[model samples]
Target: MSEIGIRTSGLSPYVALPAELESLENLGISEYQRAAKITDRMRPGIDIPILGLFGEVGSLLAALKKQTRDHPDREKYAASIKEELGDTLWYLANIASRTDQDLDVLAQRTVRSISDWDEVQPNFGTFDDIQSNIKELTQSEFEAILITLAGRVGDLVKDLGSGALTNNRDRLSGHLVDIFGNLLTAADAARISLGEAATANLLKVFSRWPLTEEYPPLIDDGMPDNEQIPRKFEILIEERKINGKIYVQQKLNGVIIGDRLTDNKREKDDFRFHDVFHMSYAVFLGWSPVLRNLLHLKRKSDPIIDENEDGARALLIEEGVSTFIFQRAIDRDFFKGQTQVDYDLLKSIRDFTRGFEVDRCALWQWEKAILEACRIFSELKRYRKGYIAADLISHTLEFRRVPEDRRED
Candidate 1:
């Protein structure tokens, strides 16, 4: 291991190398070497770190695209992001190794730079202070905060140059801190501790499709097993009706609301309205025989050749639309009273939203902005053509499964 080649005794001086980077340096693997090992081929003078970094970034983006486009489980989606980030870190570490840099030193410099920036820009406080203040924000203020946070994430994605990855670790770290700072702030405001929120998210995941949740579980021949194959689009469509009913009922029971809104008439009315949205979505999906049995869906014995058009993603989008409408209703005092359940569910959904790359927050304003575009997209489609786009907007807004399919693995 080489010395960091920097002063370590002065006040706020550069620190030694991080343990992981030291280990990487010990392995004597350079960026070009690792690139060759992974690719088994290389172009001359190609920036391996840049290539690897962008590739990983693309992987993260693709996973997000699939999540929105295909509507897989939230935890699975989160895990995909985590996987890509880890890969990105590998490339980052390789870049450092090739350049004989120290991550600890880079990190300290980043903190110092941020501290200086904070002094200059008094409005943006320290990260911890920002988190503490998130809960104190008014609805409108929180909405603005979410928008700013989103813009920062976009900036980070765009600024990921290969040179930046190797020589500008401090700058990259600053972007990461900003992103995570906003996420943690939102999590704090949502009232659930990170641990609790994570647990809740996991519970939601395991409760849904526990068996085939991870990468659809490939078979020995690399093809999905006949029994373990993903559910058909038609089946999922029917399942949504039962699932939607179950969810609305559960939501009614779970939340502590005023007597005015809890009346049978009100509850029934709300559920019916929610059902209309689903029915409208079904209409948008071209009204096949599968969707025609909207009110009463029965089990089919036939092995239908599923189009696998990624309806789960559409289901998520529809739920976002419903949530957006419901939140607006809440603003209009539709809910006579309430407790924590409303906010908890809202935060979970917001954090779980794909393509946006954000965490839990009180305001749905961020989602509302994106949802408007989705609404426009939905309007452009002619019935059946809308299914794919709608799936990206919704999936996992409800829970539905037949008795035989509900067994634990």
Candidate 2:
């Protein structure tokens, strides 16, 4: 009923579409027109702000201003001036766009040339190595080195918010030149020697290095483990009969003790043996008969009671039945006053219960893993109590549901 492949019946020359040509025509006319329109609209709005800024600047120059000389409020005015300048530039961009001119390309050509000047001029001690070779070079040479570096730095600062150099042409040029200048100056100083060609080679080698890679090691050995390891404690809540009355007594026991080790050999040994120290306890609550038959708790039928029937009897029975069991670990040593614990662990417990009403196995697994990695034996003991409580709360809340009668009421 239908043709199923490329028809190729009306293929034509690859000329620009009529609509595109019309847009280009419109762009040319709009650029100049819009530039004037935008300027007229913005001038009145900016006049008062510009006047206020000038007044402030003049007062600062004369040292007659009440505000602190380098007060942060000056930065606000600077930001405002930049914003106004940006608004003016936006109109200029529209004008350029309408005239079929690419502003970004033009800007790059201009900036790249200026950056060339920045590379050759030198000023002293502007780069990090200036202090080491201060004696070898004259003041003029040092100043020249610094001036070159400063120009390159300015180019970098300009490139920060400029989207025109997406290909990083300006950045690469600026860096190469800056490093070359630094290398030449350093070599002349005799404090640290690196030729211009060698420095260029180094730059080329490092140019492709991923910026997101982990920072180079600051110290020779390794960073010390500063994180406080939590103690693990298994909290067991046992149902018992005392004085002919059924009651639950919650007991906290240290399952895995945590400790901090400075020795690298001991640290590795502790890390390997930490998993074997954990303890687990089953926390029991009331049994449900419906759960035995259904393999889960089922909705109970509501008994329809007459208005005259005892309301207190139903209320007492409902109140006496335990609907939920809660367990939490006392991971912090309150006696020792070590109180910091994983905030996400606590938040996950609350969020998991509130959102899905399911046992937060992911959270428990995370806590267990953390306890396993802990080095402090004492901190590990405290985490066991916390783990037990977290486990009980997560499990008991998962399948717990409200009665339909209660929902209707």
Candidate 3:
């Protein structure tokens, strides 16, 4: 229970949180203010919406600070803060409407995101409750969800480029800004004030990877290709029959690490995905699980790559990051005859990323990783102008040497 009449569940703070949704709707701005011609003096359509959205955010923060610190009356301060928040929502709703974006989509996506932590949600109430639920919410799960979200964001960008919604116009920003309403509701459901979430994220980053006087390059400008990836890993195709139906999967070094299928040795295109991307990405982020759990399904034991419940999470994230490269290859018609295994991976990633409410502390890290990943992809595009695809993958994976020090195992 929160002071704002918002209710949270063990499943997620935002999952179907009606009170938060209703509160956001109630925070409507006056039609008179929306029609004001003051912004018409400037950039008109572009400047007004953008400024209105951010300006209201600023105002909301200011009011919150005053309410928490300067105001003497607690009840009055709470009421004032709620009104300020409503003002912010009014601007966000206007932004969504201007861009023809769907608030329902936004709400659903936000709800799903936070729900990823459903396993831990039932065990605790506050952020401090996280410490006790650390085992259930391990680093593997965190990394998995992070990768999945990153991939979804990438796919969204690709869609935007393909003129899926707003075309190639600046309305793209408007579409992106539409998620703010759901995000606010998510914050409420997660039991953390938006201000606290932002501040905590900032402090977490500053405490760990502090800013340096001279920042390092995105990818190290190094010497030789021989040192890029230290060793090679095998990608083996295996087949199994489940209830009279045969299914194929991709295995890395004898382990059924992925769910992709490669038909036969003659199918050269089946080997399109480079294990280097998945392996190096996991190791670099220290999301690799220490123990491999073998589950008994029938006669032969099946190796579950996901170390625990959370390891399944890391796998999903890995798939998202890996999917961008794979999807790009397919889009470019690089692999003409590859066996179609799981086309729904992107859809899954998108559905989850959109619905999942980001964690209070990890949100900042996820954003940083996503931006850096975009830059990496851009660099890869420039370097692979004429080179072989393998070289491109190798060079890209070279950016982060496997962080052996951080490896859980």
Candidate 4:
């Protein structure tokens, strides 16, 4: 590719630094581009990265709108902005990688857009060196600036498909520099660091979905068998009708565990079957206070563990999470035909579980838990009853046919 961006290499005397301080320092653009590589795509194409760029921009705007409207606490809005903008930056870097372009150099070109014909050489060498150039401003002043940047990015996306810039790498690269310049201005105004966003986005994305499919580690590792989630077990989940009202119940070896459940509403939404979600949480995340309570596995050997991790508060939190997600799932057809869960949904889950042991679980594990739970719940609803075979060790949940002899009439 043609080197159409910017540089100040020979003009600056630079001091190299140690590699171990990577996370603490401003992340380098080239480093982000490399780390932001998307190897987990369902299909390989430029369209994915480009479209992701536009989509993240939209999400950032939506987040800012919420921050502007509901007036959540500063910390909450700060986190929301960081996550949304971080995702936008990830897509930007990934697009550069896919298109054989240099994001850092594009940034450098925008580093000094005016009077560049003769007035060359800035005080900075790398993207991290120019953090001082960023001038902090209030959100009121720069929200419009970011919207403008969004429009510019949207134009670039439009061109990508319209043959105006599809085959022109240099022209597209120049447009990237223009957008980057505006992005820097907006980041400064919003008091956000692109580098910081880059780092945060990495954590969010990889946590949301795995780099590869593998069984994640569970929570209850060394507890006694009685206190621990069973490594593998099956529970018969059935919909039983009594008094012309339907209820969902679980039985293990002809022994009932938890109380029978119903939608507990004027209208039924199959939320009675939400017990499947709690079970999936136990099996996949190894963190479910409701299941612990039901199975008499409250980790009571230690008062602290019992009171905090397996207590009523934890149980309520888990139930609230399941219920909230259930409401969202109702509109989403219980996430039917979805291979991936939304980033914000997973983020909200993490936020709700903050300060809890299960919060330590990765987002991908949560995604798997939700998807698997929904899958089994849909099936159980269709068949009316089935055995939920749960394996904690391998982190698997399967809906199996009830044996003929064991089937309840």
Top-scoring candidate (TM-score): 4
Error of 3 at 313 (Å): 6.3
Error of 1 at 167 (Å): 11
* TM-scores for every candidate against the unseen true structure: 0.25, 0.19, 0.26, 0.83
Error of 1 at 207 (Å): 30
- lDDT per residue, candidate 4, 1-409, as tens digits? 1111111133111111123224424667766666567433535656777777788788878988988899899778777777777777777777777778767766777766456723434322444454445556667766888789899888888888887776788777877777777777766667776677776665555555544444434567777778888888888899898899789889876789899898899877888888899889987788899988888888888888899899889989999999988887778898888987887788788878887888666777788899999999998888888999998877889998776567664
Which candidate number maximizes lDDT? 4
**208-273 per-residue lDDT for model 1 (tens digits):** 212221211111123233322222232221111353332221112124211111213434323222
Candidate 3 structure, TM-score to reference: 0.26
Question: lDDT, candidate 1, residue 59?
Answer: 66
* Candidate 2: C-alpha RMSD after superposition: 26.1
Between candidates 2 and 4, the one scoring higher on lDDT is 4
Candidate 3 lDDT: 0.35
Kindly give the number of clashing pairs for every candidate: 17, 45, 14, 0
Q: Using lDDT as the measure, what is the rank order of every candidate, best first?
A: 4, 1, 3, 2
Q: Which model is ahead, 1 or 2, in terms of lDDT?
A: 1
Question: TM-score: which is higher, 2 or 4?
Answer: 4
Please identify model 1 stretches exceeding 4 Å from their true place: 1-46, 114-409
Output the lDDT of residue 270, model 1.
36
Which regions of candidate 3 fall more than 4 Å away from where they truly are? 1-194, 200-271, 289-317, 324-396, 399-409
